[model samples]
Target chain A: MLRRAASILAISALVLLVAGMGISAQADVIVIGEIAALTGPTAQQGLQERNGAVLAVEEINAAGGVLGKQIKLITYDFKGQPAEGVSVYRKLVQQDKAVVIVGTNFSNVNLAMAPVAEQLKVPVLSNAMEPAVTTPEPGKVNKYHFLAQPSSIEQGAIVARYALDELKFKTAACLVNKGNSFATSQAEAFRDYFNANGGKVLDYIEVPAGAVDFKAQLTKIKASNPDCIYIPQYAQEAGLQVKQARELGITAVVLGANTLGVPPFVEAAGSNAIVAGTYFINNVHFGDPRLADFMARYEKRYGEPVITTNVFFGYDNVYIIKAAIEKAGVAEPEAIRTALENTKDVKILQGAGTITLDPNTHRPVDMPAWIFKWEADGTTVPMTLMYP
Target chain B: MLFQQIVNGISVGSMYALLAVGFSLVYNILGIANFSHGAMIALGAFFSYWIARYLAVPVPVAILASIAFTGLSSALVELVTLRILRKRGQGSLYFFIASLTVFNLVTAVLVYISRGNIVSYPRAFLSGTFTIGNLYIPWIDAGMLLISIVCLAVLSYVMFKTRFGLAVRAASFSIKAAQLMGMDIDAIIQGVFFVSGTLAGVTGALLGVKYAVYPYIGNFVYMALFACVVGGLGNLTGAVLGGLLIGLLETLVSAYISSAISPALTFAFLVVILLLRPQGLAGRATEEKI
Candidate 1:
């Protein structure tokens, strides 16, 4: 009798929960889906991305949200897995009824989601740097997928050119993380550009993923004596590499992707003194006068200073969706995707001036990358903006 | 460059040795791989970090305190899980699975506590490198080598010279026989766990200093397991030799050959070694005791 009564209560509670969810899914609000690595190795960046998106949504709704409706964000943790990303994408689109999806700076995850986005017909605006995320083959594009930042090819070539032309580096070594598509794509581009353009690449070393020790590899690189080292790894590995390189007395100028500017890199390196003077290609110029307000607002909201360029990626992604919705003149997935394809001069944070996605490839065209030098005090000084 | 790589290998090998010895200790007694040693390693790191950060203790003092704490935690784990299983006359297979589950649970709890964020020590413990000739050796690596040697020496002294060590050895030879001879079986097992946990704590605290502190730092236990297998499952000296060999092989392979395939090549080499000597490098073939 007691068990029967408990079962009835449990059934009624579940019914009430479902009913509550149904009521919250109002027609008055436009639902947007976001996928991020919210609870895994990359959770730090994912949380920053989520926070940025939430902040943008809050501000957008305050100014009377797009298409005469308030914005509703439904975020799911991808847990840094590509398969999980696909399932979450499906859940958000099919169950949550989202008009657009934003997120995930991880290239592999975005690559996995590209085909699913095409089939679902829901536009995805991502910060993943790999060009293959949007364009699977040369001259072929995934119409539903869009990239916010410049692709890996462009960023890689830009850094290579900066090293060769501006820094006058005659020799370089490339240390790549073989498992990460983001790192490999950049390293390949850098190597191709550097070798073709009067710079000799001494050695190209590929390390396994999640490796902490680089002393042996660094020892080999030291023998070759390169003018600079191009390390295209995530923040953790990059930090360790730089630290180990410095310890081994390899004083070559270390260059890396945007991950170098994050707090994790500095923390992993152990000391600012170790990372000082290292150059990196960054997405956002933190020193920009324009970003001052956003920085202040972010710190106030999160109770911590902005750690990575992911914050801007997350913030701009929501605004990009808002622009698409406003351009399409409707809160619908198909309409928003088409509008996103034709997106032009949308005023958003990150990069210079405004964002414009090329209709042909669905990637930002002629997006310039910011080059910064790490300071001894653990801050980055903006040096120059390079265009590829 | 070859000499420098060798130095690097030895430094790396010493770290593996520290972890492998701890793993070997539990295996020596129970004959079941105590995978919870991994959890103790992670706990050692986290406990030291918390003590140093929140309690504002000196890093050395914090490490020492964490070692004791982890030791007690390991004994408590045995008291709860292995002790009860022994009482029920359960097989070692159940204990093995229970240990792996404990490792996962601890890692998950740590992940929740840390929010999956990788953190460094609050202050620099052993920062910077001092070069001997053209070969650069970081103070942390040198310090770790010294500490590892001291730990092993102390462990050896305890294992061979002490009364408890006699009991442990006798138990390892035959637990049933040791019990018949009026030895306290449970106490010996608990003691072994405490000692193993202490070794894990030392390795964890040092590893956190060398690298960064993260919940997944416990993954180093895989290397420990590998070292134990290569060194001869029940032999202490073999565990140490196996660790050094693996480290040296990894370093030399990465330095001379391809870095990407180094792990594959190292494991392949290990497989070849195993095939040649089925009893392992230091292990002697013995009849299975029923």
Candidate 2:
């Protein structure tokens, strides 16, 4: 009976913690719920996403939040674990009564939670471009599950065009980190698009996430003498890869995913390791006055100015959600979903162009991509706009 | 290509050797596997980087100061936590848990402080490269190999040639016997922790220069404890051999075979080696008294 009592107490405490911590989901206040990775190995990402969300939310609240009902953002940090994401989302939907759920960052969690969302009949949108998240059964696509950002197929096609046509590189080699859904899909997209666009891929290598050395990988690629190298990896592996590749004297005009434009990448490739000819999928331009103003405000809030496709999507996700809620004129779950489906030509504070979420694949249309270069002083400056 | 990979392996092997020596010294003498020893090493590694780059101190001064700082911290760790646990008459498992908690706490703090940003600093001591037989080995690699040898020699002298060293070994092997023989257990243990922590600091410095401090990257360092165990638990010389063997196997597997296969390969090798040579490579066999 003592043991059973202890178990009951423990369960009660857990339930309390979950409910108490859950952001308020009420009809009077339009509460938008987000499940993001706020801690763990990819903890830096949380800072960006959270801050961007704050800036967007703050702007909305300052100018009357969601048609005079203050938009309350209730976030549950997943800490980059699937189990945590699942638990957090369950509480967020059931306990918090969250009308709509945004993301848990990585596609794996979103894909896993898709069924749960469908069961609950809540609209689920994620920033990750993983194909499996959208079309889970390969053929059967769920109408409830939607993706706000361009899918990997669309993003990869733009990146490939930037590499082959705009840059005019005849031969390119791609190095992708193995076991990563994002890396694998982006690599496949790059390979497919490059081959289709009459460009040759010299070698495609998949290294692990925790690999410390890239000298051997660079040596083999160097021997192939590819003029351009494309690496699609997260900031962690890509940081070391960028540094080690330079240290080994492989200074080929390199192209990377949006991850290359982040802090870990700049901090890792400091002093001499930062190669000048490096280009990445840069959505934020330092030259544009409006982007500059947004960056200044972002810097004032976040203390460092770094923007990515993910953060832009994250910051923009709020306004679009707000727009949808306002259009619906009610805080109903189905109404919000319908409102989101109809959102068009909406200007998100963090993006260069207006993002329009296409209702079919649930991806944004006309999401432009750019090629940015790293300076010797460790600043990632916008080099050129590659594809729009 | 082969030579380069070997040089790369040996260079990294020096790190393993340094870490191995630190682990061996503490475990053999303290009768406790200070799991915080990895975080201690990482903490030491970044201390110098913080001084040299972050605080604008000279590299040499930063290196020496950080080593001493880590040593002091290690000693305080012993005084505040380990010593209290020891006084409770519990086994080393007590220290093990305390040390593990301390490591986790320190790592959590480090993550909180650095916010997971990988920081790098230039060391003037190791800044260039030399080419031999189509392999360009960084000067830092050669420096690590040299320092590793020098530290081993110094540790050997302290263990075999010094009176305090004898007391430490005696206290660990047979605490009652050593106490009856009038050895200063506290003094000896303190000395051992200091030496162990100092070596960890040096290893940490090498790490900061080699690879920028990534949060919780020493996770693999704890995994090296298995190497130490397979080397015969708490045997100093065996720990060294185990580290070298693990390092060589890691390099070879990554080069010749697939990198993914090495985790299984190393585990299987260790299990097989333990089965064949239960006493470990350089472990001493005990005599039967009953």
Candidate 3:
């Protein structure tokens, strides 16, 4: 009886302590929640995104934060799962009481959380590149969801146009991963654009997800003798495809989405010589003079060079949120949603210096994608920025 | 294109063969499928990667060292899981579950260590392709085929021509009878695990060289399992044949039919073959061991 009473007393004390801490946490701060794939296959990208968000929050607080209050960023790990993204969104909105949420460059994760964001009535500034993340349908928009980058369709169309008009590739072949929506969406856009604009699509091969080998498909593609092969796969898969294509003596110019420009793609391809001359769409040109300060600060803070373009997404998402809250003139979810919808000419560190979300689609308007070529020495040479 | 696709199939087949032979060795002796072979495959890749990266050793030396390490790890797994279960007189089902748990645990541990980042070997090791007329064969693929043949040859010689081979075969025939005849069943099981582990280790290292190294490379175990199943489960030659056949079928289906549905087509072919011959291509009609 005495032991039971003592246990009850301990449990009550713990509850009181938790409640007190919760109340204290709500004081003098605007809570902003972030969901990222912190501990899964894409953890590196997620962590980079988190780091970028943290850096922006620190900078904002250092400069006497928005609306006379410091922003308290609460980050949750979605672990690269879509279902976890929904739960995390609910927790952030209902439990944490965050006025705005920033996060996740993964299109699927952002897509999963879009409906929940609408239900919860909190504005989510996402870095995901899927068009459907914001505008789920042609005419309808998810009011609370906003994208910080150009959609995958835009990226694909831009690459296709650049290949046809700039490189003068008359015939093209597309290698797509059927299981990944990101790859499929990009590949479809590229194919449609390329076909509609004089260039003939020789072979359109779709491989399953987790397929490491591409020799047989490349051999078939080689038979067609296309001028260029557009492979819109993730980094590792794209790396393997390019390497295998070169091995099969398919010397046609290789084109890919942004994933091919990352370190993993180079690493997976095994050598610079193998990947040399491959063209890929990029989010940011790493050698851009304007990005020098941000890169230096990131390297200084993280003790490593900025690895991927996700840093820009994370950094820009926080700044976008801050701009929204400031524009709203009140630190409420509904007001922030309105301000984000009307977001125009906000300065952030990606694509042509400023972001203006097309309130209709909730995606940035006239956003340009940078095209980069892999040099023989493994360094990426930024060629030109193509606007959609 | 047909010839090139065939070459591609054979190249991929050789990889599946390497993994299948290892998996078959364990199933031959113990009717249970030891899923921990998957963990050993992953460990083999990571071990070689760690050695080459941190010790800064040459690639060949690192591979050899990792092979030995993985062999010991396989034996350790046997000691901790299978041997304990055997002593307890438990069913193979328990070992199956335990082996799967080990596979997941090791992969999770690797995910933590590598931070889920896919990494390649620090230095170039067989990192280029060579062409033959219109045929483009990567040095890594050729190397893997040669290595697979040599490993199979050596394994065959050991299994058919050695005293240890006699003991192992005796145990497979009947573990109780073998023990009654004074054969060390425990030692034989440990030996089989070690050999299988070495095969897994070599496969992992070569796979890392072929593709980039990542934690989930153990997913290759599924192909290995498929190879073993399609081959006579206990038949070594059947395993190789099944591996090559599956590789050829996958390549051909993708080349001629549809890359999108190639996996489904390949599995459907497997189902047809199994329905036609339940004993597998090389397996003889016999009573179920388990």
Misplaced by over 4 Å in model 2 are A1-26, A40-44, A200-202, A215-225, A296-311, A349-352, B122-125, B284-290
Please give, for residues B176-270, the per-residue lDDT of candidate 2 as tens digits: 77878988776777777788888888888877766667667556466457667667666777777787777766666655565545556767888
Give the CAPRI class of candidate 2. acceptable
lDDT of 3 by residue, A86-155 (tens): 9999999887889889887777888899988888899999877778888888999999999888888999
Q: Which stretches of candidate 1 lie over 4 Å from their true place?
A: A1-25, B287-290
What is the descending lDDT order? 1, 3, 2
Clashes of each: 0, 1, 0
Ranking of all predicted structures according to TM-score, beginning with the best and ending with the worst: 3, 1, 2
C-alpha lDDT of residue A365 in model 3: 93
Highest DockQ model number: 3
Tens-digit lDDT track of model 3 for B18-68:
999999999898988888999999999999999999999999899999999
How far is A86's C-alpha from truth in model 2 (Å)?
2.2
Write down the C-alpha DockQ for each prediction: 0.80, 0.31, 0.80
Q: Itemize residue pairs with steric clashes in candidate 2.
A: B45-B204
Q: Give the higher-TM-score candidate: 2 or 3.
A: 3
Q: Taking the true A–B contacts (Cα pairs closer than 8 Å), what share appears in each candidate?
A: 0.74, 0.19, 0.83
CAPRI verdict (incorrect, acceptable, medium, high) for model 3: high
